[model samples]
Target: MTPTAAPVLIVEDDRNVLDITSFVLESAGYPVLTAMNAEEALLVLAGHPEVGLILTDVNMPGQMDGIDLVRRLRESGNPVRCVVVSGDALHAADRLGDLAPFLAKPYDRRSLLGAVQAALVA
Candidate 1:
């Protein structure tokens, strides 16, 4: 799917990260939806069927982290794609496996945009 085909839901607890991510995606011409945590992300997911991708922070402060959120979505057969962003890149693969691409924190603009584009297309 193209980046603009559907809105990208960004799940981040950090205010600055959320703002930066949203700005970057918006500037890149992709529509964005923001959620401060996993619960909010789930709520947004329930409300917005047009969402195509979920870009989430791995270590969010909620009943479920990003990994858990993605797993839940998978278990429920949600087809929406996802990308997990985290500072701890080492364990991301083991924790998330093939569920989604893992983007390390401090990712550059080009890398972030590339990952998002790849995820959307995949």
Candidate 2:
């Protein structure tokens, strides 16, 4: 697949949130992959080089949260783009800096699609 058409890897512990996000992205014609936490996300990324973007929740039940996951990816020199989503937007944004775009939780379809599209092009 082309870079823009590459799959989006979503890391979310909440099954409902994961399902909704996947549905929205897939309905918009983007390929989707999912992991429940950062560890699973890392494994998925290692196995799927075609995953161009990561849309991850900030909080999860794992050794590494979403921010840590992005930091790990960056520290390891992975160039895949990322978008961080959280209900606690302020805290996440403060820590995230320019690492990735922040999309607040309870995001509507339009906002979610907009963030994903922007990150894909970025």
Candidate 3:
């Protein structure tokens, strides 16, 4: 564990998953930030510069989608690593883009934590 546990930002429109994921990360010893969409995510990221990882869904109801969020994050030269999880397999390839270690939805707890660890470690 780090002296200051890395903040993991979880962006998901689904309220259940958002809360569950936040709880998962929190229990795993990672600081977690929850957002319903890209707009809210941006607001959270703006204040907490310690954010070291992102776990987002592909489809979200907001001004910017998860792919756009990751792309924009990269465009801004932020080092925060990303893990895009979605139920849509067809869109995964395109949406994942340069972001590696993507997970399909309904992911197991181990897989989720593994992905988070990899992203944060990266």
The local lDDT score (0 to 100) that residue 108 gets in candidate 1 is 85
Candidates 1 and 2 compared by lDDT, better number: 2
- lDDT for each residue of candidate 1 in 1-122, tens digit (9 for 90 to 100): 34466999999999998999999998888899999999999999999999989999999897999999999999999999999999989887689988889999988889999999999888
Candidate achieving the largest TM-score: 2
Among these predictions, the greatest lDDT belongs to: 2
Model 3's alpha-carbon lDDT is 0.83
- Worst-scoring 10-residue span by lDDT in model 3: 93-102
Taking all chains together, each candidate's TM-score versus the true structure is 0.95, 0.96, 0.91
| lDDT per residue as tens, model 2, 22-90 | 999998888999999999999999999999899999999989999999999999999999999999999
Off by over 4 Å in 3: 2-4
Alpha-carbon deviation at 79 in model 1, angstroms: 0.4
Q: Total clashes, candidate 3?
A: 0
Clash totals in order = 0, 0, 0
What stretches of model 2 exceed 4 Å from their correct place? Answer: 1-3
